[model samples]
Target chain A: MKSSEWPLVIFSLAIQLSAGIMVIYDLFILFPMYRSRVAFPSKYHWILLIALGAALVGVIFSFLHLGNPTNAPRSLSNIGTSWLSREITGVLIYSALLMGTTILHFVMPSAGRSLKWLVDLTALTGVILIFIMSKIYMIPARPAWNSVFTPLGFYMAAIVMGASLLLLFQINHGSWASQKSLAILTISIPVIQLAILPIYMSWLGHPDFAGGKGLAILLHNHLIAFYLRLVLYLLAIAFGFWAFFTIRSDTTQNRLLFAPALLAWASILAAQIVDRLLFYTQNISPEGF
Target chain B: MSTFGFFCDTSACSGCKTCQVSCKDKNDLDAGIRFRRVYEVVGANWNKTDEGAWEHDIVAYNLSIGCNHCENPACVKACPTKAMHAELDGMILIDPNKCIGCRYCEWACPYGAPQYNKLKGIMQKCDFCRDYVLEGKPPACVSSCPMRVLEFGPISQLIEKHGDNRSVYPLPDPSITRPALFIRKHPGAKLAKKLNASIINREEVKE
Candidate 1:
């Protein structure tokens, strides 16, 4: 199916950003401090609870796009023919698994070596969940969303945005290592994005992409918008590459990398919003009936 | 058994969107929500080519789409919730209450007919307006198309009316989703065949 409208994309992005922020807050902010042998109020329990709760809220927020919210359960019925159903099922399963792992982490944090192994396993599962989320949009039937790079592109975009926001939080919290961490992720993400952007755009500009009605709409009666989108994506790629190439070896002690990487990260975020907006706005839904 | 089908004549279609409006009206659908939509496709972006010569050969193509009621509906097989079902009469219907807003059908459907109502927490799509059809009436979209681009009847009848010419592209030749629709062969098809023969001849000469 075609992507949702701009308003819906903006709303979903807002929720996703919020949920992502909270997730980062709990993982990067709270967890590190808890592990640092510093005195913290209450236990990590409260943070875990909050993170899970916020994720649940995010899940609920996702429901806002449904036409028949009441029939949420039946979405699973069409798995044989639908990717969305698989995504929903995957999300539910992943959420449940995450919740379970969160509880286990809280209730029995003393699993020692086994705990490390479990955490690694759970992280892999989270990665898989993210991949599945990307797959939800990668249907070949919709040429715009069908390319091999789509899932990877979306994942990189999410990670770029997510990691950028996380670094932003860390920087705000006065973490000296934020720059180092930010530099590393920023460099990698853009490199990945640069490699993927061409493929993604090629798919978008494919000789056969007659279905990107949203792009066609945005490009309607004018070529400027198309060029503008092109420039935005190119700029995003350039900034990412610049940040990657200009990586300072002294990042563990320097501030310059932080500024540029932060800017690059912000640019990437902006690029994503534009990309997502175009994605939603450019679709020509099969004349809906 | 009933095999529902649609007949669209691009030459006659004025791109009025009557099919879209009628589908929405009959389904009692919400605004900003479409069960059928009409698209206008303009021809080649010649300037993008290196030749710097742009040829604007825009053709007006109007498509009124809904559930194709396919023989091998990808939406049905992929649905984890079992929300969509094809009846004996070859109509695919979604039970809104049963849909969990998963949006699987949306992805599975090449036609992009299954819609997710975020507020309702379920999926909804055109049931061929089967509610009226059962009562011996045509679907709102079929009856509403002023240009008569959207016609519904038995699959066999549609095949006879317009055989194997429903889309500019071959309509996913593998038929993975088994979408049931037809394309009208335009003059472009004839031109393409001519071009293809010349290209093959050129390749043979080069070889």
Candidate 2:
């Protein structure tokens, strides 16, 4: 991949991770609290705030991907036809909602119950943001990225990162059942990614212009990186399962649960980073080669 | 609308690269940016004769290319800021003021027409030498071709005069963007593809 595209790698991953974090928070924490009055731990506002921080980081890096950051605001002008425009709009709306939600949690803690709808809206926007982001790479000329794998990889990477990160965060904060569930989610997403790998490779292995070239790139040129990505995913899956079994059915604030969860997060982060790098490499233009 | 287009007689192109140099000079492109590129398609294979002797059949040709200013340009549709748009004559161009320099159009164009200018921090491409076209002159590459291989005109006229062959070996399918390039294929292009010919000068033209 070109060095110039590195900013895009970080931008896509960070946004997906941020969206994943908000979605997980909405599903595991906010929904339960809204429905059953499971009052959040005192430091729970930090979660949404962290999500917003990640979103901000993503948005900032997105500008770094541009040739003229000053003109980025005009990038939204063509949402009528351009997926890039739609993606920019989605990022702006998602980031704004995330900021507003985080502000509400920080400024009006007592009013948290009344603002469930706002949090839900922010989470929904985040999901749509990831979808729009994936659509940016679904370019018809870029046959390597013009497939279901683009959206699937984005979603799975986001979910795994979110689940792993939440497992680390809630080690001593949340209930055992929820932490265990997060661990299971962490395990499943990567495992599902592993399952999708061969099918994606097989599709790429077909004897055609883009397919043969993409498979050759992965297997011949970037073989070490491809293997490293796979190994990281497998390592993440193993660490997730370890974290899952480590958590007991008690509220003893287990200190031992931290290592595997942290490892899982770290491994999955590396995997996703490598995955993004590899994704850009797959931009095998039909004419350039 | 009068759509600008390119007519490349690949049969006459001798890999001289004068057209490519002319475009680079006219646009003042840097080392990594090529508004017009020449691809050398080369391949050969050996065959066994009835006399039990091996004979090789070789094919080689050049494709000197620039922006086609397509009727359905992927770059135009892909540009988020509307910087890459078509004029009334369908000559696609980039407006620097509105360009975010995201380079999405560069990726969307199958012909690799849109090139990133590191100095300008924006996407740049062949404008069909719109200024020259307006002044009743041909594009730089077209005028500069020593062999008279490159030509440009209204796309329909080019197609009708050139028999509508828009792509040859290794070029993308023209149907993808309905590119305005009409080509007179080199006689060896079919043999080149059968032998799995590829662009041999990729390093020289990389963007």
The root-mean-square deviation over C-alpha atoms between each candidate and the true structure, in angstroms, is: 9.0, 1.7
DockQ of each: 0.33, 0.77
Residue lDDT tens for model 1, A177-259: 54345545655666666566556655555544554443446556335644655565556556655554544455444344456
Model 2 spans > 4 angstroms off: B49-53
Superposed by TM-score, candidate 2 places the C-alpha of residue A110 at a distance from the truth, in angstroms, of 3.0
lDDT of 2: 0.86
Q: Write the per-residue lDDT of candidate 1 for residues B1-207, one digit (tens) a residue.
A: 238776666556776777877777777777656776664432332234467766543333444466677777767766667767777776777765466665657766766667766566677777777777789888888888876777788778888878855454323542555566665644443433223211112121111
Global fold similarity of model 1 (TM-score) = 0.65
Model 2 lDDT per residue over B111-138, tens place: 8888888778899988888889899999
Clashes of each: 70, 0
Top candidate by lDDT: 2
Q: Write the per-residue lDDT of candidate 2 for residues A203-222, one digit (tens) a residue.
A: 88887745387888888888
State the lDDT at A244 in candidate 1: 45
